[model samples]
Target: MFKQKKQQELREICKSRGVSLTPQRQAVMRALAARRDHPTADQLYEDLCRQMPGMSRTTVYRVLETFEKLGLVRKVDSRASKAHYDADTTLHPHLVCLNCGKVVDYQDREFGHLEPPVFTDDGFQIVDYAVTLVGFCRQCRQDPNN
Candidate 1:
């Protein structure tokens, strides 16, 4: 039920933005929406390749780029070298595991209430922001070796 509603919302958003909702685009959106792990383009490509055998890695990259530009997705920076994509565009925090390279969503009212620092003195206009807390995850903490 949620997926269907999201699909409709996506279609409406695309229409408003004059973006074409191609089959490939929809497939990519669904793939991102289905996972909250903030997967990289290659990860998404790998998963979709089994179903879309002919889909190229370049196409996946391009689709994700388009989605990011359309504000349908967010490109999150992680400890990993590659950038990860998030389908949820809402303003929220992320908990990144330094050891396992895992990314998890984090929500804190106090953090959300904090105001953005003033940077106008430096001629920087803060349009938006995101907070990411980095630390060891439960699995890593349990391992004595780590």
Candidate 2:
């Protein structure tokens, strides 16, 4: 249901923005929306390639870039070197596991709420922001080797 809603939202957004809803774009969005975990483009490509034999890594990277520009997704910040994407673009905090490189939405929405001034002292406009909390996840903490 969540994936369907996101796909519909993507369609509406594409239509409004005068962008063609290409198959690659649709596939990328569907794959991203289907997951709760924030995945890197390479990870997405691996999953997609099994289903879409012809899909390329470059295409996934490009489509994700387009989606980010179109406000269909958000790039999540994590300790990992590769970029991670989240389909849920709303303002919310993320809990990043330092040990396993896992990123998940922080369950408590009210915890990190913030309202910044429109302009900073240097006259830089504050358009957006993200809050990420880093720590070891339960599994990682319980693991003997980690």
Candidate 3:
């Protein structure tokens, strides 16, 4: 379950941002906030299908995109082709299980403070980034079937 305080904060942020807190969007937000596993838009739609029978895949994708734009969610970097959504937008790293496509949050203060590598000839501006460590998760590592 999502923390009550966090949910209230989200509601207030939505109100301040002038984003309509529609039922579908609210449901999606709750779903995202409740889980640590970074889920794709399709996964969220499937999870909410019973509760939001009328909701469409397009709506879920749009709402996630909007939330990402508003800084309410983070679009996690993944090896998988599908985009993953994270409600905890704080700067942190992620552990991606290649076998099962699971994403778990990893927070290390030291890691957050590490400076990026210097770029010279490329002249590319270094911005913010989320570190992703990819490997098999416990379940996958334990089960050869995976």
Candidate 4:
């Protein structure tokens, strides 16, 4: 149901923006929405390759970039070198595992509420923000090797 809603939202957004809702774009959106865990472009491409035999990694990367620009998805911040993506665009906290590079939404949305001024003393605008709490996940903490 969540994936379906996101897909529909994508359609509406593309229509309003005068962008073509390409099959590759829809597939990328669906794949991202379907996963609960934040995944890198490579991970998404791997999953998509199975469903879309001829899909290329470059295509997935490009599609994700477009989605991010369209505000249909968000690029999550993590310690990992690779970029992680989240389908949910709402401002919220995330729990990032330093050991395994796992990124999960912090269940409590009110944990790090902030009200920043529109412009700083230097005239730098505050358009967006992210709150990420770093720590080892339950599994990583339990496993000695992790």
lDDT of each: 0.84, 0.93, 0.83, 0.94
lDDT of 1 by residue, 37-141 (tens): 899999999888988888899999999998888788898867688889998888878889888788888757467556776677888988778788899999999
lDDT of 3 at 119: 63
Worst 10 residues of 4 by lDDT: 137-146
TM-scores of the models, in the order given: 0.85, 0.93, 0.81, 0.94
Model 4 lDDT on a 0 to 1 scale = 0.94
Ranking by TM-score: 4, 2, 1, 3
Clashes of 4: 0
Cα displacement (angstroms), candidate 1, residue 72, comes to 0.5
Better model by TM-score: candidate 2 vs candidate 4: 4
Q: What does candidate 4's lDDT look like per residue over 38-141, in tens digits?
A: 99999999999999998999999999999999899999989789999999998989999998999999999989879889999999999999999999999998
Candidate 1, residue 28: Cα displacement in angstroms equals 0.3
Error of 2 at 112 (Å): 0.8
On lDDT, the leading prediction is 4
Clashes of 3: 0
Per-residue alpha-carbon lDDT of model 2 for 12-99, expressed as tens digits?
Answer: 9999999999988999999999888999999999999999999999999999999999989999988789999999998899999988
Model 1: residue 59 alpha-carbon error in angstroms: 0.8
